[model samples]
Structure formats: structure tokens, C-alpha cells
Target: MSRGTDPYVAGAMDRRIALAHEWDELVERVRRLGPRFASFLAPPRTQDFLSAVGDGTAVLINVARECHALLVTASGVTAVPLPGLSAAEIADRTERHLTALRRTDLAAQRVHHTQQRARVRKVPATYQAHHAAKIEMAEAQAELDRTLLPQLAWLWDTVAEPVLRALGSPARAGAEAGHRIWWCPTGLLSFLPLHAAGYHDGSGRTVLDRAVSSCVPTLRALARAARAPETEPAETDKLLVVAVQEADGMSPLPQVDEELRLLEDMFGPDRLTVLEGPNATREAVLGQLPQHRWAHFSCHGRQDPLAPSTGGLLLTDGVLGIKELGARAYNGDFAFLSACMTAAGGLSLSDEAITVGAALHYSGFRHVVAALWSIDADTATALTGDVFGSLTRGGRFRPQASAAAVTEAVIRLRNDSPAHPSRWAAFTHIGP
Candidate 1:
């Protein structure tokens, strides 16, 4: 019976059990240390967070009743009130917007299969379903515009503008061109696009108008990322680019090929290890993660509302769940997720920051770029290419400068596609 069993498998199982016991012992020891040591184990203090901002940057923490804006400049930190926006209102609007987006996506799928469905036996049912979906999408679009725009304007007036004023309004000194602000919204506000909040009446008053926007899961996360040691760009610095365009039971992302080709050109084929199509398995990607300084995934992302921690990037073999991700220790600089809804935290786990972006942050990546909602393939490709281009300009990869690089890249996309907030607003930087 011992000879029949695989020795390697048995050895791995033994190691896992030993590790589990060690982890349990460590946890018990920590518990015995009591509440005095708990603060040390917890997130950093407000002063530590203020130091992380490092001039010309602010951090916004949105809670249930109201939002707190911490304007951190070279001098000190100033806490300001973001009035007229509550958690309940944010939750309502988020649900409405997400529902509208889902309807629109279903309509798009129906439209794509219209010609194929026309040839099927149940033509009438297919046609009726498609037509009904189209009508639903139109109504949802109208409703979204009617309800969401006003809320965005209100957010701009109440939250963003106040934060801007507290920071001395970077727009006045032409500082908006270079200044950055990191938004750290809690609860339901995580689903809303605080970066795109603006008065849509052609007033040119928006968050983007004042400063480039980025996001962080927490101020403590930002502080930790800022303290990450900078490494010089070398030939040994490898990038792992995973593209799952043809996964089973999923629509093919034909544009991902072009995206990968573009990335290869920017990062050089010698430095990038491309795991694409059938080879982009969960085990393959996870095994290679520790070897690379940067990783980019162009695939589908599923956010499990009921079990947010179980949600992950959809690879060829299976989902690369956040729980699996948190088990790894990495020293990577960034993880750029060119997938849909990578930053959409479930309502129940809203304050917990249980999303792919946050997972990457916790997994030891200094910076993470992920989407707040589903993004079109073409737009994602363009945005990602521009981001990499900005980061690697003049044949140098500056990981420490990712915040500005990501912000500027998104700003460029917003300028080119001014009418479509969905295109430019979905992708956001989630750390320093």
C-alpha cells in the first residue's frame, strides 16, 4: 500500500499539514499577546498614513453616514467633511447602475447572436427575447443617465470639490496636470466611480479637472506600498503576461491577441513570458508569479457576491481565487488586471476590500490596476497599452512612478473618448 502511493504527493500532503499546525500555533501565540499588541498588528496610524501621501495627494475615506476627506500636503493633514452623501444613497445608486449595466451587457450578447439564433427552430422565441432585451437595455440606459448623472454631480459638489478646496484646488495653479489623489472609499461607495464624479452640464467641473485620481484599499496599504524598495530595471526583470482568450464556455476575446502583441513590443519578447490560450492554467500562472516582477492578466473576472473571497480571475483550468492568492508571498511591483469587474467588492464585504485588486495588494504587489466594472476588450487593450507605454517611456521601467503613469494613461483615454465614461472610468490604479 505504501509503494502504491506516490511519494511526491505524500510528501506534499505532509508538508501542508505541518504548515497548518505551525500557523495555528502562531495564531494562538498572537492571541495570548492580547489587545496591547493588537494595535501593532493592525493598520498604521493616521500620522503614518499622512506621511505616505507625500505632498500634493489626499486620501478620502467614505463611511456609512458621511465621508471623511484627509488632505495631506507637505505641511500636515486636514480632515474635512464631505456632506450630502450617505452610505444608503450610495448603495441604492450602485445597485441601479449595476443592474442597468447587466441589462446592457445582456442586450449586447443577444445582438451578437441574432443572426445565429435566426436560423434556429424556435425563431419566434429567440427573436422575441432579443427584441425584449434590446428594449430593456434602452430603458436602462435612459434610467441610468437620468438617475446616475445627478448623483455624480452631487458627489462632485459635495465630496470631490470639498476635498479639492481643502487641498487648495490644484486646478488653479495648473497643478492638476501633475498632482495625484488617492481615493480610499469604504462600504458601498466602492462600487461608485468617485474619480468620474462631475457636473454633466458642460461646466467642466469634475474630479479629473482638479487632479489625476487613483485608489487604495486602505491608507495603511498605501503606506506599505510606498515603503516598497525600488529596484533598478535590468534584463533579469521578467514580466508574466497571461491571456485566456479562448477559455471553455466563455466568449473569445479576439482583441487579446493584439493586446499581447502590443505588450510584447513595449516590454520586449525576451523579458515577457506569455501564458496564453490552453497554457494559461491556474497552476501555471501561480507557479510563475513569484519569478516575475510584474504580471498582467487579460481574461474574464468573476466577483462572487455571496462569497467575495472565493472570487477570482478566470483562467483556462479554473478560478485563481483570492484565498489562494493570499496564501502566496510575493515581492512583485505590480499586477495589471485587464479583466472585467476586478475591483467590484461585494456589498456584504464592501468594507473588507475583498476584490482581485485588493487581493493582489495583500499578496505583496506594490501597485495594482484593475477595473471597477466590465470594460470592452478594445478599450481595455488601448488603455493597458497606453499605461505600459507611459511607464516604460525612454526604455526605462519605473515601478515607483506607477501612480502618475496609470493616472496619466487613464486621463489620455478619457480625453480621446470624452462621451463614454464607462470606457475610461472603469480602470483605476489601486495602490501607490
Candidate 2:
């Protein structure tokens, strides 16, 4: 018998068609219930889902027992199998990353102590081990690089390179300015730096090299950011600079003042609402968010390892935790969080992508620049200048160009210190 005339094949086709029709009927019935009911339902059509992607390609990846990447573009959806990745491998690597990160924190502390001690004319007897601390810091940094570099290379070979190949090269795709790629990583993958995935040994085939990478907690989050109304110029064009130079109980960020100065020069005083020191209270910052089109938080950010939601940008009065950030839906364009670990998620809740940076994006900032780990204060200052300089070029607040701007700034930083991934790899853009 011919394949078309086969009973089993015909039965399967009929069942599929019947199920599709029934699904459509059910969808229509739900729609008829009212706008509230309909709002809960996702659009049934493929094009409806594709529309949320905008000009960029959204790669929603699942790294679980079974690993795969669902690439959504304007054209359609395509599945790219991540055969090299495994659940066990991801789990093991994530643990290693956490260990290395902790070591990094210790190293930073030692380095900071050494610097503080050196500043004094006569070193106190209690802090006489400053030289020893410096040596230990260097050793710790070397140890961190060993794990971090290999992880990047692994991600490149297993995940990024294949996905990039499937999407086609930026040159071939006619995206010399860097093709925007929204990384929607799930599970353990959320903990890894997919944006900085690459072989850093002068191989121009890195994720940063090919695409202007931006992260979204989920596809829905990206759509929400896209659908948010733009803040009007009539309301305010002010770039809110919330520089908390020294939050109580935290190490002082001396470069924050310099960052504010550079921002003042790049964007004049009239265009800014400077809230530094005691003025950048949680209430004040939240109040000012609604009035500004853009924001820059030059302060220390804290990440709670056990309770992710407790993580927030360290302000003057208190820490602005993630849960409190959603008090109002903002219409702001962009936010630059030049602080430590603004983008780092909790180890226990690695799948949730719960962080201060994601909270800002959720709160309605279209584009957010954040750090995946602790960043150097000097590097943060320079990077902030580069980012804002790009955003406010020709005296225009162009928030749409933020992702590309961050990419360029990070690339510049990477080029300057090719051997140090810690300096450049931490900063990532989260948005559409």
C-alpha cells in the first residue's frame, strides 16, 4: 500500500488536525471570558510569539537532563541541539565556579587591605602582613583564572560556537555593528556567563565578538521590557546619578566620585539629578526613578547567597532588595549599575536568575548594565564613562544603543587586559 493510503499515517494526521482545531476553540472560548482572562493566555499563533523577539534573535536555552537551545527570530523558530552539554557536567562546573568566586572575593579583600595599608605613612603593627597579603592575593587570582578560563572555553566549544554557527556569522548576516542576541538561559546555565563564552586566545570567534549580547531572565521578561511605554522627554530627560560613595558598614568606593565627575562632564549638570551619599536613600532613589529617563547607580551591590531576593544595590539608608524594587512599573530607558555583583544570582537558586540587575530590568528599565561578579573600582569607573559617553553622544540620551555600547566598552577593557577575564567578563547587559 502507498504511504498516503496507510491507515496509521492517516489516523495520526487526522488526530493532529482535530487536536489543533480543539485547541483553537478552547483559546477562543477563553478570549470571550474578558480581557483579564485573555491576558493570562499566551497568543496561540507562532507569529505572535515571534513578534516579541523584535529585531534581535532570542535563544531560549534549557540545560537540564536534556540540553537544547530554542532560537527564535523574526523568520521562525529553530532548535539547536547542545550535544556537548550534560546535566552532570553543568552541575560540576557550577560548583567549581562558586568555589572560584569565593576565592576571588578573598583575593579582592587581601588586595584592598594591602592598598589601604600602603597608603599610610607608617604601617601599623597589626597590619604588618600587607606584603604577605599582596602575595596571597596574586596567588588567589591565578587560581581563579585557572577555573574561569577553562569554563569560558568549554562554553564556547559546547554552547556558544554551535549556536552562533546555526545563527550564521555576523559578517554574513550583515550585522557589522554586532547582531543583537538575547540569551534566555535556564537552570544551571543561568549561573554561567554565556555572553563572555569564548576562547580568549586571540580567536576572534567569541560571543562578544560576533554579537551584542543581552540577557533576559525569560522570554516573557524580554517581551515585557519591549512592551513598556517609553518615558517622555516632556516629563524628564534627567539621567539620575545615584552615587553612594560610602554606604555604612561597606568598603568605600573612592572611584565613584570620579565616575560622577566624568558623567557630569559627559552629560552636563542640567541633564542630571545627582543623589550622592546620604541623599541616595532607598525612598529617594525609588522616588527619582519615575522622574528620570535613565539611571546610573555608582555604589556597592550586595548578593545574598542563601536568599537571592535579599540581594540589592547598597544605598545610604539600607539595601534596596529585589522584592522592594517592583513597587512601581517604571518607564525608564536604561540603568547602569557600576557596583559589585549586581548581576550575580544565588547559588542555591541558580535556575531562578534572581539578582539585583534582573530586578531593575523587571522594574521597567529597558536596558541594564550590570556586573556578573565583583568588578575592579578603577575598571568600573572607566567602563561607566565609556558606557555613558556612548549613551549621551552628541548630547542625546540614546538608550536603545546601550547594549552595543556595553559590548564595546567591555571589549575595550578586555583588549587592554587580555590575560585578566575578571576585569572584563563580569559586566553584562540585560534587556531587549
Q: Which candidate is the best by TM-score?
A: 2
Error of 2 at 52 (Å): 2.3
Q: Whole-model lDDT, candidate 2?
A: 0.83
TM-score of each: 0.83, 0.87
Weakest lDDT window of 10 consecutive positions for candidate 1:
170-179
Model 1, TM vs. native: 0.83
Put down candidate 1 lDDT per residue, 1-432, tens digits, no spaces.
287889899999899999999987786688679775655444467776767777657566656455677666547777788676676677787778777667666665665566346557466887786677667656655665565577678778768888777766655322236457888887778787887777644455777666767788877788888778787765438889999996655567767898899888988878899999899998999899998889999998878655788788999998988888878988889889999878888878788888998998888988888998767788888888888887888897776677666666766776785656667777788776
191 in model 2: Cα distance from truth in Å? 1.6
Candidate 1 off by > 4 Å: 1-43, 62-67, 72-74, 108-148, 172-178, 200-202, 234-236
